[model samples]
Target: MALYRIADINVEYEPRFDMLRERSKKYLIGPSDKVNFKISIKNDDPSKPGDNNSGLSDAECEYIAVGSSFYKGLISFNGLLLHASAVAYENEAYLFSAPCGTGKSTHTSIWQKHFGKDKAVIINDDKPAIRLVNGIPYVYGTPFSGQFDISENISVKLKAITFLHRSDINTIKPMDGSKAIYSFLNQTIKPSEPELKLKAYKTLDTILNSVPVFEMGCNMDEEAAEVAYKAMKEGICNED
Candidate 1:
Protein backbone atom coordinates (compact mmCIF):
# COMPACT_ATOMS: atom_id res chain seq x y z
CA MET A 1 0.00 0.00 0.00
CA ALA A 2 1.16 3.49 -0.84
CA LEU A 3 -0.16 6.86 0.23
CA TYR A 4 -0.44 9.76 -2.15
CA ARG A 5 -1.63 13.27 -1.52
CA ILE A 6 -3.53 14.41 -4.59
CA ALA A 7 -5.77 17.47 -4.70
CA ASP A 8 -5.24 17.75 -0.93
CA ILE A 9 -6.76 14.34 -0.40
CA ASN A 10 -4.79 11.44 1.04
CA VAL A 11 -5.38 8.36 -1.07
CA GLU A 12 -4.13 4.87 -0.35
CA TYR A 13 -3.89 2.23 -3.04
CA GLU A 14 -1.76 -0.74 -3.98
CA PRO A 15 -0.32 -0.71 -7.46
CA ARG A 16 0.14 -4.08 -9.10
CA PHE A 17 2.57 -2.88 -11.74
CA ASP A 18 5.85 -1.05 -11.86
CA MET A 19 4.61 1.48 -14.37
CA LEU A 20 1.99 2.77 -11.97
CA ARG A 21 4.50 2.87 -9.14
CA GLU A 22 7.02 4.81 -11.23
CA ARG A 23 4.45 7.16 -12.64
CA SER A 24 3.15 8.07 -9.19
CA LYS A 25 6.58 8.25 -7.56
CA LYS A 26 6.52 11.99 -7.22
CA TYR A 27 3.20 12.01 -5.36
CA LEU A 28 4.28 9.39 -2.84
CA ILE A 29 4.06 10.25 0.82
CA GLY A 30 5.10 8.65 4.05
CA PRO A 31 3.02 5.89 5.59
CA SER A 32 -0.31 7.20 6.72
CA ASP A 33 -2.57 5.48 9.19
CA LYS A 34 -5.50 7.56 8.10
CA VAL A 35 -6.53 7.96 4.49
CA ASN A 36 -9.45 9.65 2.82
CA PHE A 37 -10.06 6.61 0.62
CA LYS A 38 -8.50 3.37 -0.56
CA ILE A 39 -8.54 1.96 -4.07
CA SER A 40 -8.28 -1.69 -5.07
CA ILE A 41 -8.06 -2.59 -8.73
CA LYS A 42 -9.37 -5.95 -9.83
CA ASN A 43 -8.71 -7.95 -12.97
CA ASP A 44 -12.25 -7.37 -14.13
CA ASP A 45 -12.29 -3.68 -13.24
CA PRO A 46 -14.62 -1.66 -15.43
CA SER A 47 -11.81 0.72 -16.30
CA LYS A 48 -10.03 -2.09 -18.13
CA PRO A 49 -12.98 -2.60 -20.52
CA GLY A 50 -12.01 -6.00 -22.02
CA ASP A 51 -8.87 -8.04 -22.54
CA ASN A 52 -6.89 -6.34 -25.35
CA ASN A 53 -10.02 -4.45 -26.38
CA SER A 54 -8.68 -1.16 -24.97
CA GLY A 55 -5.34 -1.79 -26.70
CA LEU A 56 -3.75 -1.12 -23.32
CA SER A 57 -1.21 -3.28 -21.58
CA ASP A 58 -1.84 -4.63 -18.09
CA ALA A 59 0.22 -1.85 -16.58
CA GLU A 60 -1.64 0.80 -18.56
CA CYS A 61 -4.95 -0.68 -17.53
CA GLU A 62 -3.94 -0.54 -13.86
CA TYR A 63 -2.88 3.05 -14.22
CA ILE A 64 -6.29 4.04 -15.58
CA ALA A 65 -8.11 1.88 -13.07
CA VAL A 66 -6.44 3.66 -10.19
CA GLY A 67 -7.20 7.03 -11.72
CA SER A 68 -10.85 6.17 -12.33
CA SER A 69 -11.32 5.02 -8.75
CA PHE A 70 -9.56 8.06 -7.38
CA TYR A 71 -11.63 10.42 -9.50
CA LYS A 72 -14.91 8.84 -8.46
CA GLY A 73 -13.91 9.19 -4.82
CA LEU A 74 -12.71 12.72 -5.45
CA ILE A 75 -16.29 13.92 -6.01
CA SER A 76 -16.87 13.30 -2.31
CA PHE A 77 -14.12 15.81 -1.54
CA ASN A 78 -15.58 18.51 -3.74
CA GLY A 79 -13.26 17.55 -6.59
CA LEU A 80 -13.62 16.24 -10.13
CA LEU A 81 -11.26 15.25 -12.89
CA LEU A 82 -11.31 17.43 -15.99
CA HIS A 83 -9.99 16.20 -19.29
CA ALA A 84 -7.91 19.25 -20.15
CA SER A 85 -4.49 20.74 -20.36
CA ALA A 86 -3.93 22.96 -17.32
CA VAL A 87 -1.36 25.68 -17.64
CA ALA A 88 -0.14 27.97 -14.87
CA TYR A 89 1.04 31.51 -15.43
CA GLU A 90 1.39 34.38 -12.99
CA ASN A 91 0.06 32.24 -10.14
CA GLU A 92 -3.19 31.45 -11.94
CA ALA A 93 -4.26 28.32 -13.80
CA TYR A 94 -5.92 28.41 -17.20
CA LEU A 95 -7.47 25.15 -18.35
CA PHE A 96 -7.94 24.47 -22.08
CA SER A 97 -10.43 21.67 -22.58
CA ALA A 98 -11.59 19.80 -25.67
CA PRO A 99 -12.30 16.33 -26.93
CA CYS A 100 -9.40 13.93 -27.59
CA GLY A 101 -7.20 14.76 -30.60
CA THR A 102 -8.56 18.33 -30.55
CA GLY A 103 -5.18 19.96 -29.87
CA LYS A 104 -5.66 20.90 -26.23
CA SER A 105 -2.02 20.04 -25.64
CA THR A 106 -1.02 21.81 -28.81
CA HIS A 107 -2.74 24.94 -27.61
CA THR A 108 -0.88 24.90 -24.32
CA SER A 109 2.38 24.33 -26.14
CA ILE A 110 1.69 27.56 -27.93
CA TRP A 111 1.34 29.27 -24.58
CA GLN A 112 4.69 27.87 -23.54
CA LYS A 113 6.30 29.18 -26.68
CA HIS A 114 4.63 32.57 -26.52
CA PHE A 115 5.35 33.19 -22.87
CA GLY A 116 8.54 31.15 -22.51
CA LYS A 117 9.29 28.58 -19.82
CA ASP A 118 10.02 31.22 -17.16
CA LYS A 119 6.49 32.54 -17.50
CA ALA A 120 4.26 29.62 -18.47
CA VAL A 121 4.24 26.02 -17.31
CA ILE A 122 1.97 23.10 -17.99
CA ILE A 123 0.74 22.01 -14.59
CA ASN A 124 -0.95 18.99 -16.03
CA ASP A 125 -1.09 18.13 -19.69
CA ASP A 126 -4.23 16.09 -19.20
CA LYS A 127 -6.64 14.87 -16.52
CA PRO A 128 -6.10 17.56 -13.94
CA ALA A 129 -8.25 17.53 -10.80
CA ILE A 130 -10.27 20.56 -9.77
CA ARG A 131 -11.45 21.08 -6.22
CA LEU A 132 -13.08 23.83 -4.21
CA VAL A 133 -11.01 24.94 -1.30
CA ASN A 134 -12.71 27.53 0.92
CA GLY A 135 -15.22 28.16 -1.86
CA ILE A 136 -12.47 28.93 -4.39
CA PRO A 137 -11.86 26.55 -7.25
CA TYR A 138 -8.28 25.34 -7.76
CA VAL A 139 -6.64 23.06 -10.29
CA TYR A 140 -4.17 20.37 -9.22
CA GLY A 141 -1.79 18.05 -11.02
CA THR A 142 -1.94 14.29 -10.81
CA PRO A 143 0.05 11.31 -12.03
CA PHE A 144 -2.76 10.28 -14.35
CA SER A 145 -1.66 12.93 -16.81
CA GLY A 146 -1.86 11.51 -20.32
CA GLN A 147 0.74 10.31 -22.80
CA PHE A 148 3.48 12.85 -22.34
CA ASP A 149 3.72 12.35 -18.56
CA ILE A 150 3.60 16.12 -18.30
CA SER A 151 2.43 16.94 -14.79
CA GLU A 152 3.50 18.72 -11.65
CA ASN A 153 2.66 18.09 -8.03
CA ILE A 154 1.25 21.53 -7.57
CA SER A 155 -2.00 23.45 -7.24
CA VAL A 156 -2.99 26.82 -8.58
CA LYS A 157 -6.12 28.89 -8.24
CA LEU A 158 -8.18 28.32 -11.34
CA LYS A 159 -8.62 31.58 -13.21
CA ALA A 160 -10.57 30.43 -16.23
CA ILE A 161 -11.60 27.45 -18.36
CA THR A 162 -11.70 27.70 -22.14
CA PHE A 163 -13.20 25.21 -24.55
CA LEU A 164 -11.37 25.14 -27.86
CA HIS A 165 -12.73 24.58 -31.35
CA ARG A 166 -10.64 24.32 -34.46
CA SER A 167 -11.12 27.18 -36.87
CA ASP A 168 -9.21 29.09 -39.49
CA ILE A 169 -9.68 32.39 -37.72
CA ASN A 170 -8.97 33.06 -34.05
CA THR A 171 -11.98 34.14 -32.02
CA ILE A 172 -12.98 33.93 -28.38
CA LYS A 173 -16.05 34.77 -26.34
CA PRO A 174 -17.31 34.19 -22.83
CA MET A 175 -19.80 31.40 -22.31
CA ASP A 176 -22.90 31.69 -20.18
CA GLY A 177 -23.05 29.77 -16.92
CA SER A 178 -25.69 27.33 -18.16
CA LYS A 179 -23.77 26.53 -21.29
CA ALA A 180 -20.51 26.34 -19.39
CA ILE A 181 -21.97 23.83 -16.98
CA TYR A 182 -23.16 21.63 -19.83
CA SER A 183 -19.80 21.83 -21.53
CA PHE A 184 -17.96 21.00 -18.34
CA LEU A 185 -20.18 18.00 -17.68
CA ASN A 186 -19.07 16.50 -20.94
CA GLN A 187 -15.40 16.94 -20.00
CA THR A 188 -15.70 15.31 -16.61
CA ILE A 189 -16.54 11.82 -15.49
CA LYS A 190 -20.15 11.82 -14.38
CA PRO A 191 -20.87 9.22 -11.76
CA SER A 192 -23.34 6.47 -12.48
CA GLU A 193 -24.80 6.47 -8.98
CA PRO A 194 -27.55 9.07 -8.56
CA GLU A 195 -26.24 10.51 -5.30
CA LEU A 196 -22.71 10.74 -6.54
CA LYS A 197 -23.93 12.33 -9.76
CA LEU A 198 -25.77 14.97 -7.76
CA LYS A 199 -22.62 15.72 -5.79
CA ALA A 200 -20.64 16.04 -8.98
CA TYR A 201 -23.15 18.50 -10.39
CA LYS A 202 -23.09 20.56 -7.23
CA THR A 203 -19.31 20.69 -7.31
CA LEU A 204 -19.34 21.69 -10.98
CA ASP A 205 -21.91 24.39 -10.28
CA THR A 206 -19.75 25.84 -7.57
CA ILE A 207 -16.72 25.90 -9.85
CA LEU A 208 -18.56 27.40 -12.81
CA ASN A 209 -20.01 30.10 -10.58
CA SER A 210 -16.61 31.17 -9.37
CA VAL A 211 -14.53 30.79 -12.53
CA PRO A 212 -15.13 32.37 -15.91
CA VAL A 213 -15.68 30.14 -18.94
CA PHE A 214 -14.93 30.85 -22.57
CA GLU A 215 -15.15 29.22 -25.98
CA MET A 216 -12.51 29.88 -28.57
CA GLY A 217 -12.30 29.15 -32.27
CA CYS A 218 -8.62 28.91 -32.94
CA ASN A 219 -5.91 27.40 -35.09
CA MET A 220 -2.42 26.25 -34.08
CA ASP A 221 -0.92 29.69 -33.77
CA GLU A 222 0.66 31.88 -31.12
CA GLU A 223 -2.08 34.45 -31.59
CA ALA A 224 -4.60 31.95 -30.33
CA ALA A 225 -2.86 31.75 -26.96
CA GLU A 226 -2.36 35.49 -26.86
CA VAL A 227 -6.05 36.14 -27.48
CA ALA A 228 -7.13 33.57 -24.94
CA TYR A 229 -4.75 34.91 -22.30
CA LYS A 230 -5.89 38.47 -22.78
CA ALA A 231 -9.51 37.54 -22.37
CA MET A 232 -9.14 35.09 -19.55
CA LYS A 233 -6.43 36.86 -17.58
CA GLU A 234 -6.89 40.55 -18.28
CA GLY A 235 -10.62 40.26 -19.12
CA ILE A 236 -9.96 42.43 -22.14
CA CYS A 237 -12.60 41.10 -24.46
CA ASN A 238 -13.55 43.02 -27.57
CA GLU A 239 -17.15 43.42 -26.48
CA ASP A 240 -16.52 43.71 -22.78
Candidate 2:
Protein backbone atom coordinates (compact mmCIF):
# COMPACT_ATOMS: atom_id res chain seq x y z
CA MET A 1 0.00 0.00 0.00
CA ALA A 2 1.19 3.45 -0.90
CA LEU A 3 0.76 6.21 1.66
CA TYR A 4 -0.12 9.88 1.38
CA ARG A 5 -0.53 12.53 4.04
CA ILE A 6 -2.41 15.79 4.15
CA ALA A 7 -3.28 18.14 6.99
CA ASP A 8 -1.81 15.49 9.30
CA ILE A 9 -4.29 12.73 8.37
CA ASN A 10 -2.79 9.56 6.88
CA VAL A 11 -4.35 7.71 3.90
CA GLU A 12 -3.51 4.34 2.42
CA TYR A 13 -4.68 3.00 -0.95
CA GLU A 14 -4.32 -0.70 -0.67
CA PRO A 15 -2.33 -3.06 -2.91
CA ARG A 16 -1.65 -0.54 -5.67
CA PHE A 17 -4.34 -1.70 -8.07
CA ASP A 18 -2.54 -0.71 -11.25
CA MET A 19 -5.57 -1.27 -13.42
CA LEU A 20 -7.12 1.82 -11.87
CA ARG A 21 -3.98 3.96 -12.10
CA GLU A 22 -5.05 6.29 -14.87
CA ARG A 23 -8.41 7.22 -13.46
CA SER A 24 -7.10 7.40 -9.91
CA LYS A 25 -4.25 9.64 -10.92
CA LYS A 26 -6.58 11.91 -12.85
CA TYR A 27 -9.04 12.25 -9.99
CA LEU A 28 -6.68 12.13 -7.01
CA ILE A 29 -7.10 15.29 -5.00
CA GLY A 30 -4.29 14.47 -2.59
CA PRO A 31 -1.78 11.79 -1.61
CA SER A 32 -2.64 8.47 0.04
CA ASP A 33 -2.72 8.34 3.82
CA LYS A 34 -2.77 5.59 6.45
CA VAL A 35 -6.52 5.04 6.10
CA ASN A 36 -7.25 2.43 3.45
CA PHE A 37 -9.51 3.54 0.60
CA LYS A 38 -10.25 1.83 -2.70
CA ILE A 39 -11.43 4.05 -5.54
CA SER A 40 -12.50 2.90 -8.99
CA ILE A 41 -13.71 4.84 -11.99
CA LYS A 42 -15.46 3.55 -15.10
CA ASN A 43 -16.89 5.06 -18.23
CA ASP A 44 -20.51 6.01 -17.83
CA ASP A 45 -21.06 3.79 -20.86
CA PRO A 46 -18.59 1.16 -22.01
CA SER A 47 -18.61 2.73 -25.45
CA LYS A 48 -17.55 6.12 -24.16
CA PRO A 49 -13.99 5.50 -22.91
CA GLY A 50 -13.53 2.82 -25.55
CA ASP A 51 -10.89 0.81 -23.80
CA ASN A 52 -10.61 -2.98 -24.01
CA ASN A 53 -8.88 -3.41 -20.61
CA SER A 54 -11.48 -1.42 -18.68
CA GLY A 55 -13.22 -4.65 -17.75
CA LEU A 56 -15.21 -3.35 -14.83
CA SER A 57 -18.95 -3.76 -14.96
CA ASP A 58 -20.66 -0.39 -14.77
CA ALA A 59 -22.30 -1.19 -11.44
CA GLU A 60 -19.18 -2.41 -9.65
CA CYS A 61 -17.18 0.61 -10.70
CA GLU A 62 -19.99 2.89 -9.61
CA TYR A 63 -20.05 1.24 -6.22
CA ILE A 64 -16.32 1.68 -5.81
CA ALA A 65 -16.50 5.32 -6.74
CA VAL A 66 -19.29 6.21 -4.32
CA GLY A 67 -18.85 3.62 -1.60
CA SER A 68 -15.06 3.46 -1.34
CA SER A 69 -14.75 6.38 1.06
CA PHE A 70 -17.10 4.88 3.59
CA TYR A 71 -15.55 1.45 3.24
CA LYS A 72 -12.28 2.99 4.39
CA GLY A 73 -14.04 4.85 7.21
CA LEU A 74 -12.62 8.11 5.89
CA ILE A 75 -16.15 9.41 5.51
CA SER A 76 -19.55 8.30 6.72
CA PHE A 77 -22.06 8.35 3.89
CA ASN A 78 -24.90 7.32 6.14
CA GLY A 79 -26.47 6.48 2.81
CA LEU A 80 -26.33 10.14 1.85
CA LEU A 81 -23.99 12.46 -0.02
CA LEU A 82 -24.18 16.12 -0.85
CA HIS A 83 -23.04 18.16 -3.83
CA ALA A 84 -21.96 20.99 -1.63
CA SER A 85 -19.02 23.20 -0.71
CA ALA A 86 -17.82 23.70 2.86
CA VAL A 87 -15.35 25.98 4.60
CA ALA A 88 -14.11 26.67 8.11
CA TYR A 89 -13.61 30.01 9.81
CA GLU A 90 -13.43 31.23 13.38
CA ASN A 91 -13.75 27.72 14.76
CA GLU A 92 -16.95 27.06 12.87
CA ALA A 93 -17.86 25.16 9.72
CA TYR A 94 -20.45 26.12 7.15
CA LEU A 95 -21.92 23.93 4.44
CA PHE A 96 -23.67 25.09 1.27
CA SER A 97 -25.30 22.29 -0.68
CA ALA A 98 -27.27 22.28 -3.89
CA PRO A 99 -27.73 20.28 -7.04
CA CYS A 100 -24.93 20.52 -9.58
CA GLY A 101 -24.24 23.95 -11.13
CA THR A 102 -26.18 25.87 -8.54
CA GLY A 103 -23.13 27.90 -7.35
CA LYS A 104 -21.74 25.97 -4.37
CA SER A 105 -18.26 27.00 -5.37
CA THR A 106 -19.19 30.58 -6.06
CA HIS A 107 -20.80 30.91 -2.68
CA THR A 108 -17.73 29.50 -0.98
CA SER A 109 -15.45 31.77 -2.96
CA ILE A 110 -17.41 34.80 -1.93
CA TRP A 111 -16.77 33.99 1.72
CA GLN A 112 -13.11 33.33 1.12
CA LYS A 113 -12.81 36.63 -0.65
CA HIS A 114 -14.59 38.47 2.13
CA PHE A 115 -12.66 36.86 4.96
CA GLY A 116 -9.29 36.99 3.21
CA LYS A 117 -8.34 33.94 1.21
CA ASP A 118 -5.71 32.66 3.63
CA LYS A 119 -8.11 32.73 6.54
CA ALA A 120 -10.76 30.81 4.65
CA VAL A 121 -10.36 27.52 2.87
CA ILE A 122 -12.83 25.10 1.31
CA ILE A 123 -13.15 21.82 3.25
CA ASN A 124 -14.76 20.01 0.31
CA ASP A 125 -16.33 21.36 -2.83
CA ASP A 126 -17.77 18.08 -4.03
CA LYS A 127 -18.24 15.71 -1.11
CA PRO A 128 -17.71 16.57 2.56
CA ALA A 129 -18.19 14.16 5.43
CA ILE A 130 -20.92 14.75 7.99
CA ARG A 131 -20.75 12.98 11.31
CA LEU A 132 -21.62 13.53 14.94
CA VAL A 133 -19.28 13.67 17.90
CA ASN A 134 -20.68 13.86 21.41
CA GLY A 135 -24.07 14.47 19.81
CA ILE A 136 -22.83 17.55 17.99
CA PRO A 137 -22.75 17.48 14.18
CA TYR A 138 -19.46 18.15 12.48
CA VAL A 139 -18.25 18.28 8.88
CA TYR A 140 -14.94 16.88 7.68
CA GLY A 141 -12.93 17.40 4.52
CA THR A 142 -12.40 14.44 2.26
CA PRO A 143 -10.00 13.81 -0.62
CA PHE A 144 -12.97 13.43 -2.99
CA SER A 145 -12.76 16.94 -4.27
CA GLY A 146 -14.52 18.21 -7.37
CA GLN A 147 -13.90 21.21 -9.68
CA PHE A 148 -12.05 22.87 -6.80
CA ASP A 149 -8.51 21.69 -6.05
CA ILE A 150 -9.06 22.37 -2.37
CA SER A 151 -9.07 19.12 -0.49
CA GLU A 152 -7.09 18.68 2.72
CA ASN A 153 -7.89 16.58 5.74
CA ILE A 154 -9.71 19.04 7.91
CA SER A 155 -12.79 19.14 10.14
CA VAL A 156 -14.82 21.61 12.09
CA LYS A 157 -17.78 21.51 14.41
CA LEU A 158 -20.72 22.31 12.15
CA LYS A 159 -22.16 25.73 12.72
CA ALA A 160 -24.95 25.43 10.24
CA ILE A 161 -26.14 23.77 7.03
CA THR A 162 -27.71 25.97 4.40
CA PHE A 163 -29.41 24.66 1.29
CA LEU A 164 -28.68 27.01 -1.56
CA HIS A 165 -31.16 28.58 -4.03
CA ARG A 166 -30.87 31.51 -6.38
CA SER A 167 -32.40 34.86 -5.57
CA ASP A 168 -32.29 38.48 -6.75
CA ILE A 169 -30.92 39.51 -3.36
CA ASN A 170 -29.52 37.84 -0.28
CA THR A 171 -31.77 36.19 2.26
CA ILE A 172 -31.39 33.58 5.00
CA LYS A 173 -34.33 31.79 6.56
CA PRO A 174 -34.40 29.28 9.38
CA MET A 175 -35.12 25.71 8.33
CA ASP A 176 -37.41 23.38 10.18
CA GLY A 177 -35.49 20.35 11.39
CA SER A 178 -37.85 17.84 9.77
CA LYS A 179 -37.73 19.67 6.45
CA ALA A 180 -33.98 20.06 6.77
CA ILE A 181 -33.56 16.31 7.07
CA TYR A 182 -35.25 15.72 3.71
CA SER A 183 -33.20 18.43 2.00
CA PHE A 184 -30.05 16.99 3.50
CA LEU A 185 -30.94 13.52 2.30
CA ASN A 186 -31.73 14.76 -1.19
CA GLN A 187 -28.24 16.23 -1.48
CA THR A 188 -26.60 12.85 -0.91
CA ILE A 189 -25.46 11.05 -4.05
CA LYS A 190 -26.27 7.42 -3.26
CA PRO A 191 -27.44 5.24 -0.38
CA SER A 192 -27.78 1.70 -1.73
CA GLU A 193 -27.87 -0.40 1.45
CA PRO A 194 -30.43 -0.21 4.23
CA GLU A 195 -27.80 0.14 6.94
CA LEU A 196 -26.47 3.25 5.28
CA LYS A 197 -29.96 4.76 5.29
CA LEU A 198 -30.42 4.05 8.98
CA LYS A 199 -27.04 5.54 9.77
CA ALA A 200 -27.81 8.59 7.69
CA TYR A 201 -31.08 9.19 9.50
CA LYS A 202 -29.32 8.96 12.82
CA THR A 203 -26.68 11.41 11.66
CA LEU A 204 -29.34 13.79 10.40
CA ASP A 205 -31.21 13.60 13.64
CA THR A 206 -28.04 14.47 15.51
CA ILE A 207 -27.48 17.42 13.20
CA LEU A 208 -30.99 18.74 13.64
CA ASN A 209 -30.72 18.65 17.38
CA SER A 210 -27.29 20.19 17.50
CA VAL A 211 -27.10 22.91 14.88
CA PRO A 212 -29.23 25.43 13.10
CA VAL A 213 -30.38 24.59 9.56
CA PHE A 214 -31.22 27.36 7.13
CA GLU A 215 -32.27 28.07 3.57
CA MET A 216 -29.82 30.53 2.00
CA GLY A 217 -31.03 32.37 -1.09
CA CYS A 218 -28.89 34.97 -2.74
CA ASN A 219 -27.76 36.66 -5.91
CA MET A 220 -24.50 35.56 -7.48
CA ASP A 221 -22.49 38.22 -5.69
CA GLU A 222 -20.34 38.89 -2.63
CA GLU A 223 -23.28 40.36 -0.78
CA ALA A 224 -24.59 36.86 -0.54
CA ALA A 225 -21.60 35.86 1.57
CA GLU A 226 -22.05 38.79 3.92
CA VAL A 227 -25.72 37.99 4.40
CA ALA A 228 -25.05 34.37 5.17
CA TYR A 229 -22.19 35.06 7.58
CA LYS A 230 -24.16 37.59 9.56
CA ALA A 231 -27.20 35.38 9.73
CA MET A 232 -25.18 32.38 10.77
CA LYS A 233 -23.51 34.34 13.51
CA GLU A 234 -26.89 35.35 14.83
CA GLY A 235 -28.44 31.94 14.47
CA ILE A 236 -25.67 29.67 15.68
CA CYS A 237 -23.54 31.70 18.04
CA ASN A 238 -25.89 31.27 20.93
CA GLU A 239 -26.33 27.57 20.22
CA ASP A 240 -22.60 27.15 20.35
User: Best TM-score goes to which candidate?
Assistant: 1
Clashing pairs in 1: none
Report the number of backbone clashes for model 2: 8
TM-score of each candidate structure, all chains considered together: 0.95, 0.72
**What's the lDDT of the predicted structure labeled candidate 1?**
0.90
Estimate, for each residue in 1-240, the C-alpha lDDT of model 2 and write its tens digit. 444432223444532334333223433445433454443333453443224537764433443454345433433533234568988888788889888888888899899988987877888777777766656667776545664456556768788888888888777888776788778778774456676656666766767777777887777787788788877767632112
Residue 163, candidate 1: alpha-carbon lDDT: 95
Which segments of candidate 2 are over 4 A away from where they belong? 3-80, 236-240
What is residue 66's positional error in candidate 2, in angstroms?
6.1
lDDT of 1 by residue, 10-71 (tens): 99988889988987888999998779999887867754844657678888888877888889
lDDT of the candidates, in the order given: 0.90, 0.64
> Candidate 2, which ten residues in sequence have the lowest lDDT sum?
15-24
lDDT at position 204, candidate 1 = 88
